[model samples]
Target: MSRPLVIDEAEVEITAIRAQGAGGQNVNKVASAIHLRFNIAASSLPDDVKARLLASRDSRITQGGVLVLKAQRHRTQELNRLDALARLHELVQGVAQPPRARKATRPTRGSQLRRLAGKSRRAVVKAGRGRPDLS
Candidate 1:
């Protein structure tokens, strides 16, 4: 998120294919869906970004480091292509920034004392319900 990275169209392989599912008769007749594939290894993205992307373990990514996406949400071919590109950008951006290192922390003294005090109050209530001195 620090810097927006641009993906060149040449790096992506987009193909038009028929969209599956319910649609007037046009679904079977028109190739309105788009199949997009981008090879992370061959992209111009930063080396660190590429490494993280490949290590992401996303099922959409093939063993060869290719990201495959299918966009058929839109009825138009152009819209579907744009949708696929947008999704690709989103994926690349997700892995662009490295994760921040975690810092070790400990509970404050006041919090520790407050927890013990609550436990003592509960114990007294439970003990009162147990027996009437059995006398």
Candidate 2:
């Protein structure tokens, strides 16, 4: 059986705010934008995953170790809420999958020879660019 996805509900927080940009009269009145906040430090995720999530260069993650995602693309509150939650799930899942470690490698002898040959060819072409000695 496939394992269930584990997420700590306590680590996430959500709030509604007025979405900016064009929306007619309704935009000024209603707070439809969903703000989802996830605290990396307080999360129940593994240390490695937490480190990756916190170290990520995403603009959503603030300096205070909180990830803030805004979902205002959807018109309704329910859809916006779902979008925010899905984004959170995706972000967590991304960190959950660890990257494979890279093994050190060296260039092959043939590759080295090819590179040297290419450099020699380029040098000959450049050498030809010089004016012929008139003397």
Best by lDDT: 1
RMSD of 1: 3.0
State residue 50's C-alpha deviation in candidate 2, in Å. Answer: 0.6
Off by over 4 Å in 1: 110-135
As a whole number from 0 to 100, the lDDT of residue 78 in candidate 1 is: 96
**Model 1 lDDT at residue 52:** 96
How close is every model to the real structure, measured as TM-score?
0.79, 0.90
Query: Clash totals for all models, in order?
Result: 0, 0
lDDT of 1 by residue, 1-135 (tens): 387999999999999999999998999899999999999999999999999999998999999999999999999999999999999999999999998999999999999999999999999999989758856
Residue pairs with colliding backbones in model 2 are none
Compared with the true structure, the alpha-carbon lDDT of candidate 2 equals 0.87
lDDT of each residue in 29-113, candidate 2, tens digit only: 8888999988988888789888999988999899999999999997878899899999898888877777889999999999999
User: lDDT value for candidate 1?
Assistant: 0.95
